[model samples]
Target: MAVKVAIFDWDGTLVDSVEHIADSLHQAATELGYPALERAAYRNIIGLGIEEALESLYPGITRADMQAMREGYGRYFFTKATTPREVFAGVTEMLADLRGAGLGRAVATGKSRRGLDKALVSSGLGVHFDITRCADETRSKPDPAMLGEILRFYRIEPDEAVMIGDTIYDMEMAQRIGMPAIGVEWGVHDQDTLAAFGPKAIVDSMADLRRALELL
Candidate 1:
């Protein structure tokens, strides 16, 4: 059966914004008097929402501190980041191909609407997704709310769509919803870690992902 919708996990999957994410996180940590999170620590929290990331980085941080950190990170990221984030190679082409195939493409992400919009716009891929859901509106990932919303929006069964992401949160969400998932290796999560989530397959490159999607 043909897949009707392709739901993507944004940050690491479509755009290589992990470095920006981590840099902002580090700046936030410094502002809050917490130690900066290294890339590995940042990687583990990438798929989850900002709250989860802050909680993981500062295990006992107060609510006030969390709010401060979140705001601080956004300020730094939206301002200090020099180069605009670029979409991964072949992502635009692949999305165009999927759209041409009469497939609906949506982004289900942990980023808030503003953050998601900024990333997509900066990457010049905002025109690709037909629908988008961010952490601000839905329950965070591994909860299935966003993916469920995507399925509902497209009016398609879980089997009619595939969730593609680079994190365990993405795979876990797909699994809980009984949806097939594809993991990408070039993203934040390690392939082994992503494999543990029981994705339908893991592709090493976006080109490989395009092939995996069978977009001819």
Candidate 2:
């Protein structure tokens, strides 16, 4: 099917928030008396839900600790962290091009609903998307549930939409549901790692991504 909608991943895909996320995770861990992990370890979990990411980083953590960590991460990320988290370069123009082409735009992200909402406002990109799904509202990445919800909302088939993200989890979920995927190289995962999931194309910049979508 020809593409009717473009579903995007938020953190590393559209916004350059990976480092800020890692720093916030580190602060949260430290606040909870958890051992510090390298930044790369935190980056690797960027595409998963906060709870899932926390679990992976600190395995065997108690439920109470998980709750505390989640709260701390949110506090640090939203209020305390000083790192700038802006939309990727040319992303606004790329989104405008997609809109002009009559394609519906949406976000399928690992961020919580609260986080995504705040980001949409702060980034001034909220007006571009017609719909959005958050990990807290649905299943996290690597599962097709959230994608399914977006498809249902748009009333389109899996093949009628494209999933654009920077992680294997995003591609895996799209592949599982028979949706086409495009990977961005500027995110947490490298090109080879993203390619392993079989995206239609892995782009290096917003211009390249727009060209890839045009060809699709």
Top-TM-score structure, candidate number: 2
| Candidate topping lDDT | 2
What is the per-residue lDDT of model 2 for residues 143-171, given as tens digits with 9 covering 90 to 100?
Answer: 99999999999998998999999999999
RMSD of 2: 1.8
CA lDDT of each prediction against the hidden true structure: 0.84, 0.90
Off by over 4 Å in 1: 80-85
Tell how far residue 190 is off in model 2, in angstroms. 0.2
Those runs of model 2 whose alpha carbons end farther than 4 Å from true positions after fitting are 80-85
Give a tens-digit lDDT track for model 1, residues 27-143.
788876887656788767887888876787788899999999889988988984322336777788888988887889999999878888777766778788899998888888889
The global Cα lDDT (0 to 1) of model 2 is 0.90
Q: How many residue pairs collide in each prediction?
A: 0, 0
